[model samples]
Target: MRQSFGERFDVPDGYLNTASIGIPSASAGEAVAAAVAGWRSGAGRAGEYDEYVERARAGFAALVGLGADRVATGPAVSALVGLVAAALPAGARVLVAGGEFTSVTWPFAAQADRGVTVTEVDLAQVGPRAAEFDLVAVSVVQSADGRLVDLDGLRAARGSGTRVLLDATQSLGWLDADLSWADAVVAAGYKWLLSPRGVAWMAVGPELAATPVAAGWFAGADRWAQIYGLPMTLAPDARRLDTSPAWYCHVGAAVALPWLAGLDRSAVHTHCVGLADSFRAGLGMEPAGSAIVSVTRDGAGERLAAAGVVSAARAGAARLAFHLYNTEADVARALDALTP
Candidate 1:
């Protein structure tokens, strides 16, 4: 039999399915369900809806150990990243890891076209190149093998002038990863945070909030109303970075953050590690410490997909991501489904 391993959180029945991509959910997602229902109907922008959206920003900030004012909501992770690129200077030397998820990689390419000098490097070697780049963007966990990068070291290496954008989609809820060093972080509510797919958030530090490049209409403080087709004075925090209304998505993302806050992150981390370990032990796969286990083989993605199991490819390996909602039995079931 070929080797197999899985995280208990990797189980697919959860709201956020890591089977498709990124981190598995760590909480329930009732808020999003309500938000979407409201959007679908003509409910459109109600006061309660807007309040929940703001609450979601606070909830997201709470999870990352930041002030609520520092968090901003987006339509999706991709849109949040676009805002980041738009905010940075056109000539900024943006550094990204080679072989990152395309969502991250393509943004830089577009940034390059707009004038940012984009450099893709092996992040293991980022410490050396950090001083030269104006900004360093990285996925908290490598999307392929779920390799956890030393974010603290990376931040220090960037020196005081550089901005660090960390994508926590793969590692946010479970891992004991410290995000205090980051200037900005964008993550999807679906992955790891247990919300649905429509929500994503970006949190910015105090310094960046004061002077953002992509200043949006939704960023103003107080009860903002149109004053002759112009934006009112902006808010003091990260909300200023948000350009449009993502009211519905906010409801779900907000609920997910606090719900995850109830569970023990340390326990979830241990559970994920243990489940990954169990899969390796039973399947004889080489043990990789990530919440994900991946391997290289011909037609690997196709093979797994055909078996009713979904996995993503990175370079030569196929990755199976896991998280808090996954159970031991899930690994077994997926393995059975994948039987060749």
Candidate 2:
């Protein structure tokens, strides 16, 4: 029998801060706990962690609808974005959405010394103006206010020969979209994927021709065998772009990701968005069709905290996110806190 989402997580009522960090499932928590216990007792083998890394890589591939060979493991999205930033030709024009998370924009912006100009446009305009730029980098969902990108517009822009790089940090776990067409896709595992910090993944598409500038031993075709070699030999696929695995993080992710991948994502999306819309309606706002809601009232952050409702303050608003573990009671508690 399948465990209910509520059964999988022991989240307390009034906890609504999934946008900042996710509560791990009971199984994942136990796996990490056991791994830590082994480490503390000097009973853990480093060699065993390689399997965990591979399992996590494959699970993320399944979630994003890609092959494991196209996915590269890393510790941070910024580091993976740096790999792509370094591959751009001198004088390349990069288009980015205004207010995009710096991890997606700063990497390309940092390359200005090489004549790589990163131009910021309204989030809505990124796709229509894509043909004018060499590359378009943006998040699947904006981090500040939860505005969704116009994916169809980006798809049309791809037809015009503009390469697209998407940061799915906010959307991957709940947003169901076919991302295989993009030149590259990157995500941090901690926020929505329910993994501990230090685990991330990047998918390199056929259209992206970026070289692995930060290749290390983990990037080798046979990393164990290539540990001490004069000539550097890297993996034939995206693994060549990998940073060394953070073993403990992967151990938890190996259990969490595959379990998440097996669930009916469409149902999960509906549950989350339904809760978010209910909260919006409570505040006399129309449904935004996103799982995240930003309340901009004065002292909203303090009020939520006072009411014991967990949320994040970002861009001058109190941001509340709904996930599978959240329920209607949480929305009511937050509304009670803010309205009264």
Candidate 3:
């Protein structure tokens, strides 16, 4: 409908080059391009590192519904996880939703050294049974099925003392989320956020500001200012959790959010839904989710990969992920490519 805008985004003429990953945009490119020039000219944001950090903080706050200062920028989500895990008391029993991306689990697993107890939700008994754990965590969206989980409903299930954390990497840019109940949240810039894959995570409640177990030079009064010895007073906010965030990364992420926000997010959601729905209708393949779609076909994973149909093998099914710019025709092309 808005060809002028669509042309600027460079939506593909065919099936999206994005599947099982995020689609980068012009704003992202421009940010990195500036970084290159800044680096070569030695004119980077040396004095404005904190300013960039503030920019990142504001976006994180706006996107996830947290205070700007409460957002912390790390190198990636993994780094953010490490900071969270480091801050938590030892022997905390962590309850996570049944299926989570690797970033959520691996860090907790490593924390076994700290006597952390990690448990996956028994989706079979997922009601009040989950109430037993001290900490509860879930992705905003299902990584496998790609279903958007009702975060508010789940967080409300826990007592006030029971902390809730959200992994928002999958749906940050395109989907509207209710983050009121979360104690902390984490995301990356790679996919939907459309920025350099700089890491960022934030805790909403003041309780989490008590500990930022991992500290780095960038976490200081002067961003580039070096520090020795242990971390001092827990940053009154999420800044404590961030060790290092690329200044240019802030510029890129800032540039991307407006464009993403300007697009009809509801329309983006609808188009993705319709495309997944149509893939099912045309191919007679009942696929799943807005982010990832799956059509069952035995031994077809290898075959499809060979045919340049970028996808993944999931729970005895083939999962195809689509994005904002993907057209129905692209779905048809993929369906055609997969046809026997």
Per-candidate TM vs. native? Answer: 0.82, 0.97, 0.83
Model 2 spans > 4 angstroms off? 1-3
Per-residue alpha-carbon lDDT of candidate 1 for residues 1-340, written as tens digits (9 for 90 to 100) = 1111211232343212363543323233344555566678867565566776766777777778888777877767667777777767778887888888777767667766668888888868665677688878888887777777767667786466777888887787777667866888888876667666677888877554224455555666653563246545777667766766556556656666765665676787888877766665555676666787775656656666665655676668777766666667756655654444
Whose lDDT is higher: candidate 1's or candidate 3's? 1
Q: After superposition, how far is residue 311 of candidate 1 from its true place, in Å?
A: 3.4
Residue pairs in collision within model 1: 8-326, 8-327, 9-323, 9-326, 10-323, 31-252, 32-252
For candidate 1, what is the lDDT?
0.67
Per-residue CA lDDT of model 2 for 207-305, tens digit only, reads: 787668888899998998988866999999999999888888999999888887887988989988999999999999999888999999999999999
How high a TM-score does candidate 3 get? Answer: 0.83
Superposed model 3: Cα runs more than 4 Å off: 1-7, 10-20, 122-128, 150-152, 221-235, 262-264, 285-289, 302-308, 313-317
| Best model per TM-score | 2
Best lDDT goes to which candidate? Answer: 2
- Looking at model 3, report the run of 10 residues with the lowest lDDT sum: 1-10
Q: Give the TM-score of candidate 1.
A: 0.82
lDDT of each: 0.67, 0.89, 0.65
Distance from true position, residue 337, model 1, in Å?
5.7
